[model samples]
Target chain A: MSGQTVANLMRGHIEALAARGERTDGRGANEFRDVSIETGLIGTAEGSARVTLGETTVMCGVKLLAGTPYPDSPGRGSMTTTAELACLASEQFEPGPPREPAIELARVVDRGIRESQMIDFEGLCIEHGEKVWVVFIDMHILDYGGNLFDCCTLAAASALAHAKIPNVQHGIADKDVDLPISCWPISCTFAKLGETIVLDPNHDEEMVMSARLTVAHDENGNLRAMQKGYNGAFTVDEIKTAVKTARTADKVLRKALKEATK
Target chain B: MAGGNSDIKFIKKGKRLDGRKPDELRKVRIEVGVLNRADGSCYLEWGNNKVYAGVFGPIECHPRHKQQQDRAIVQARYTMAPFSVNDRKRPGYDRRSSEISYIISQALERVVMVEQFPRAAIRVDMQVVEAHAGTRCAALTAASVALADAGIPMRDIIPSCAAGKVSDTVVLDLNKEEDNYGQADLPLAIVPSTGEVVLLQLDGHLTPDEFEQAFDMAYKGCMDIYEIQRAALADRYGGSA
Candidate 1:
């Protein structure tokens, strides 16, 4: 979409929601929609997760590959994200080349995991600057209910946590070792709709939302990363509320992660 | 069924395995609306083999020439997901997928009421998420349920099942091992109400009587699957499947 139309449409919704003091979907300031996650559902993939953020459906799969680590981070592993805006989802998403919108979505999701230090990149190093562990995280959008950044994060993180690296068999001059992953970071999103900040915005809500925020947290309620959407300015008060609400949700999210491990 | 193999065996105790008295089927389960995006979608687990199907159009026929004035054309493609099998299957077309797609499309075309849509096309995408045995039959059966779930009109529901020969004895619903090493396999797709076969594929050696026996076994297996198909359709949109 062109910059002018996107800005105009979003700016108008921002003003309307702000003046109303409530969400168009009737959600409270901090209440998240009922979010249910199911893991280990797909028989394929080392680890798989399906997350439905309201109506937006996202599925993530983690595939391991042998590769050389970057020159600087030779001792660490890496993660790559790919998003497909399938023709089945919406007509606006054309088949063929990955459009700018898809690239942006992948980058946004990649930033949350990369910046947060989700994986122990160093541990993935097989031989410094040589052979290393490459974690390929593929994100698929089954439905477009909106808030893909948060939904993809939730799905990717859960799939990572549930992922099991196969027992490695290699020849480093008679030395073989099994790779281990210590932690998986989880990402959750918050949206500022008018005066109200909601968790897990639905598709319609996303269309009408003023600004959306996403934060990645670890099992210990530690902040790993943060991002905001819509290029809107938020007051310090709104930012504080988002952090507080996310931290609270972090506890439940952690529990959800643990239960998902089973 | 083979004697020495993997975690799950198809034969045990000098008889067809999974505790079926030679002519038994694997446990079958079906669920509709498995995929929220597709107009109609369903998932099925016929024992270890799992398949998912979605029906998308009947909307518009593209490429112009494919359109018809009197009836809609059924365009179906059956694909296996990359991670669907034990060894990753590359996305897109393959010999096995193409063959299955042809058979599934032919089977579906027999029952779908194409006249209703006129110049449009009803596209059914069947994905085998996991493959054990009887994948084609399972895919065909699940696709009909998905089509029904999507509320597309059909002359009749197409149900399919495979009956094969193992250790000189015909067994119903061959599992993964039975499919690979069995003597003969006959996969059949039938319309229960009409009692007419729309899909018929046979591989391996079987005498005339043996073929008759296998066909009967497969027919019973189709009926077994039909119950689940009916139940799944009934759960969504409300009606007798």
Candidate 2:
């Protein structure tokens, strides 16, 4: 049989099971797969984290470097976010300029952090109109299941939250100071198959999902960023319900980030 | 990057900067069948934003390998003119345009009856001649009308709009200033018949209650846009007044 035939068959099976409120892994609709976060994994980097959500694994490294500030925002520091999705992570990813999926992943993760107002960009400034610390968050995907947005966000936030600014190395000061973070932003992803919506969808669920929504919220239950993906539609009620669920899920993910940092 | 200027007031005395109510949408006008050579075409003007959409093919799939045996693939390319915004945008595809193109393609594929045309491809091109915010929603809404003008069968026409929090209040169909200075923005597209959302994206800060209010506002805005779309198509097809 052709690849299309196989995909069609799998989609049919998944939809049938979804209609009955069941998943292949026997997880509940609101349940997330086993989540684990390990921080300070890379010794050379200022800070690093590895997060595994079900079968998906992503590693994030945060590096701080002193550089000239942008012309417009001399008093504040800046951040550059980049993601690498290579063939090693999944067959679907190719070796080229970052594709749409990788780009989207990086941007969504960046928005949550930037919009949350968590990072104190002003504190990173060494001198107005001159030098400032530029924070770079790099995410590398090691495994592919589903829900890379949440994994990447989790890893990036954890790595940033625990990162130390190398003040001594940059010659700004003799002692290193912790990266200034005011809050933690947590993102929860949901997939819609048939009429059912499930949180933290696995590889199979992602493959068959008609639509995908990722909602990010801060510790105070403030909605920070959201992105809806794939070829699908949802009712207005469905989105409202997702927002309510995201508020509840924020606590669990925030706890994970805190525990990993500790 | 950082939040916009807080000094600029977007709402005062229950009216917006444009002297409109919070629930009112910006002035909108859409023209269908604008292109002579294309199978279908549409031009849309919403506030200061100007967008054009053209549809072509159900033709033979290119490169051969991408063609599916069972169904046609829908390809949508969203691009912005260099002079569209306040700053000159770099020409050609960028990360932002690529992502927007992808989501628009997905939403179009859902409505277009692609399975009816085997081993073929439908190309939809959207160009933002001017942008003042909400260009993606405008482009997608225009493309749907262009598809209809091309005589393509669809499950339903999709209408798109945005609702956002400006001055800590949820308002419908935010204009450029409101979008930039607002606390949050939610762009949504819905199939009016089924009340199903085809596209949704949100950014900035909002509480759970604020999100609900914005969602409701945007949903109603989409319904209003739907009526306009139907009327535009009816005007072209000589339907009932």
Best by TM-score: 1
Task: Please write out the lDDT profile of model 2 over residues B172-231, one tens digit for every residue.
Answer: 887778777777888999888888888999888889998998899999999999888889
RMSD of 2: 21.5
| Candidate 2 deviant stretches above 4 angstroms | A1-7, B1-241
DockQ of each: 0.22, 0.01
lDDT of 2 by residue, A1-262 (tens): 2223454568877777778888888977787778899887554467778798887877677878888999999999999887766333443443346788888999999999999977999998999999998888878665667789999999999889878998887678999989999878899998898888888888777877899999999888889999999989988999999989888866767788888877
What is the C-alpha lDDT profile of model 1 across A54-102, one tens digit per residue? 6677767676666788888778888778776544444234334567777
Docking outcome class, model 1: incorrect
Worst 10 residues of 2 chain B by lDDT: B82-91
Q: Cα deviation in Å at residue A94, candidate 2?
A: 1.1
List model 1 lDDT by residue over B173-219, tens digit each. 88777777777889999999999999999988889999999999999
